[model samples]
Target: MSIELPQRPFFLAPLDRENSGVDFLGLRQANLDMMGEMIPSINNVTSYIRPFSLLSWIYWKFHDLCTEAGIEEATSDDLRLFRERIEVLFTWGASLHETAERIPGISATPPPDQDGVKPLTFDAWGRVQSSTSLIAALWYGPASKTVTGLGFLSPVPGRGGFFRVSRAGAALAQALDNKLREDGERYNRLLGTLDPVEANESDAIALWSLWSPETVEHEEMASFSSALTSEEAIGSNDTLLSRRSTTFALARHHLQEVGAEQSIPKIRRGMCFSVRPDGSNYDVPTTLEECRRKWLTLQMRQLQRLALETLLSWCEDQILRYDVVDTSAMAERFKKSWALTEYGLGEARNLAELIFKLDTKSNSVEDFIRSVNTNDLPDPFSIMAEITEKFRQRDPGFAVPCFFGLLQCASFAGAENAPPNMVQLGSAPRLSLRVLRHRLVGLGDVTVAEAFEYILEAMVISQHFSTAVNRFDGRNQRLRLAIEETGLTALVSSAWVPTVTEDRLAMLLTLSAQSDLVSKNFDGEFFSNGGIKNESI
Candidate 1:
């Protein structure tokens, strides 16, 4: 007999797994060592800002402010302050709003037509950073800005058309598309999905099922209709013809219910209900069944609006301001246990990557949508060869700008009998580190929290960073010089990779570690080579 294991909570599995590990050249090794003497509780502590919890915060936030009250009814100033939040939500939907929120100051929406500081200043590289990202251009920059960042999107701005229900009626239109009714003069005024006159509800449903497009032309139903309409013998001799005519009688009754003035038409069509009124027909609005179904239609409309921007805008803007994207461990862990999206955002991202590599820049937004529906992606490896040949004269530096995607693809490495051409990333590069410390020039020891905060603040500033206004105008020069010496390379890929080379990653890892806010305790035993191999924690 096989053993069965109980399913684990989605949140707990990752929380426990990432708590400790044998990291070779990564920050974990060095961080473990430094915190060993400072505090024993670091690795053992719980965190509010772990990867899974943080990604799902938006969902919980919606439940708190939007879904309960309903999206159409939402008055969240965060949703109302800037229209970009609505646009981003529609593009990325509920799943990707977490990433949007993390781009510092994105939630700081000033009310429409009012002054607000621009979110996202440039990064160390000066462009292609979070502040200057393609999303930011469309979300915050001027209406005329052109974006080439990933290449799949066009700037579509304007708010409040997202609601889908029409004033004419949703159920009638939906039923029409299903081929349940005829497009005669009666048109949308006669609904075909509902029960027909002179037939019990179940009988109307049976008549509808028997008359569908798939079975409408079936030999059996066609023969039945032929026998009923035939000139010779169906009158008193054919019992089947008599039953078939009885079955189609309800359709004829329904034409009368809609007040058709002509003589009863042949009972060739299926069951239908009339929205149009005639003196012979009873009032539909007063009928209990008709009134209930319309009320149900209203209920569905409310449910649909819950996920739209109108309801989402009612939240307290404060919940959208949670900004621990890169300073925390979130940057390193999102890939393993990601929240999935319904916006086709992944396929959109894939198509964006494919479009960026195309020789001609003439593709349209329609092309992207068509490719998404068909999933007809051009082979990237073949595209790489074609692009390289085209750029041979230019030598456009893929080595720096897109080295991440250009690196060896190993998407199939874990398969038991992996294809010979596919392989995982090779061994970690070797690096060295030393214990790090800093002090104020005239004062005493600088705290770890202050150090991490300084780097984060530096990233936010367009010019020099400062504790107060003019405290460290020179810090930008020092940080810029360090990044320049480390020689930050560029990378854009379907999956996340360190934008910098391994050497540069180590350089920042060492620098960033000395500033870690949570690096207060370490279990150094995990750092030993034998301890990593032989011991399990």
Candidate 2:
């Protein structure tokens, strides 16, 4: 038997999440009902990921690789190797150079003569030639996680340190800017006339007024973008970020200090990476305030929600879990039947709800191209906004539209994709299988494992024998049980195993001494006789 070394420069596993099942799904705590339309979960840049933190990470990683890039021994292989090292450091917070100084064969010093030739000679992240290219390659938000076309992130041209905000990004920024101005003016007019900003107004308008965007930077632009975030959002972010590595934070903060302590802040080699436009000679077309980005996000969400209604109508026609996807009602017109709270959004989410929408942003089906030629065109801003949004979805994994469940409905909005289930499932599972197991054990006195085993054993026995049980009502089932002391043994021999009513099955399990399966559950009550099956688990 033989073993081969895996081709990895940083031989450390990515860190396990600090909080494994944190919050159990953000929507449960939100004002919105988790059972209603899809929840708002920013897949990335959730409050915990501050621009400062990201900037800090990029800055130090560059410093670590700058020297290596300048060395003569650098090769293409060094790019991949050191890129992995730098990113691994960012993800797991491990130092490769420190480890190399400690470990065995990897830590050994190459002979003095070969030091300038071999990148693997272990002088540090030694082989990497161009730090900028490495930064660009790794900067596109986890190539493995993005589900977008050309993700919103397109690193700045020469210095790959900062990514340019795409035109679509600019539109989202502009869209939010427009909405903020509109809402702010509307609120002023109503308040000046002393007429109340009534409930009947658009939720966007009402929500805009409610947040008092006046408190944020731009007084006139009081949109979801300009408004100070809810206390809840702030608290959630602080709690999460507080748990990050203290060492990582200190080092990052140290690198960002100014004055004699100021080591370029975020500027290096005459190049700058900054969120604010600091006259550092680094420029990008647009840097929409955080508020604008959030605004564009909500606008897209509004459309996605509308598309969802169309999708529900679709799944109904296709007979694809129609009962779950479309819960019909005479009066509850806006009710989303895609899931019930009891089913907890059920299997609808796992139906790969967002991939098709994501695909549209890139390919824009033939239907969209045809529709574009029609005379009833929307304003150019809107059309461009939609177009740009689609382009932003190029990242294959965490496309914002999909992650937020705001799947692009371009073809979908005009009644969108007939998205087929991708051959392989990529969406992260929304529900925990363990949690599902626990819920399935619903009301049982026995552990989930025990009940599962008992069911398996019962199934095995039923395969071998059949028996009969006669009821007091003159019903003669092919199974026997109830008072039978053999209990579940009746499951093996009696026809009752196959022919008995659910009530009798409950009685059999209730009477059995070892198997603690109970019948008090909703299904048990619905399917079985009143008394016996009523025994709650």
Number of backbone-clashing residue pairs for each candidate, in the order shown: 7, 33
Query: In candidate 1, which residue pairs get closer than 3 Å at backbone N, Cα or C atoms, i.e. clash?
Result: 71-306, 71-311, 74-311, 75-314, 76-313, 76-314, 76-315
Q: Which candidate is the best by lDDT?
A: 2
Candidate 1 per-residue lDDT, tens place, 361-452, comes to 21332232233224343222332333344233332221111111121111112122221111111111111110110111111233323322
**C-alpha-based local distance difference test score of model 1:** 0.22
Q: Which candidate is the best by TM-score?
A: 2
Q: What are the TM-scores, per candidate, against the unseen true structure?
A: 0.15, 0.20
For model 1, the superposed segments whose C-alpha errors exceed 4 Å read 1-52, 72-419, 422-500, 503-537
Over 197-290, each residue of candidate 2 has an lDDT whose tens digit, in order, gives: 2222133234333322122222121221211112223212132212111211221222233211122212121111212223222222232122
RMSD of every prediction: 33.0, 30.0
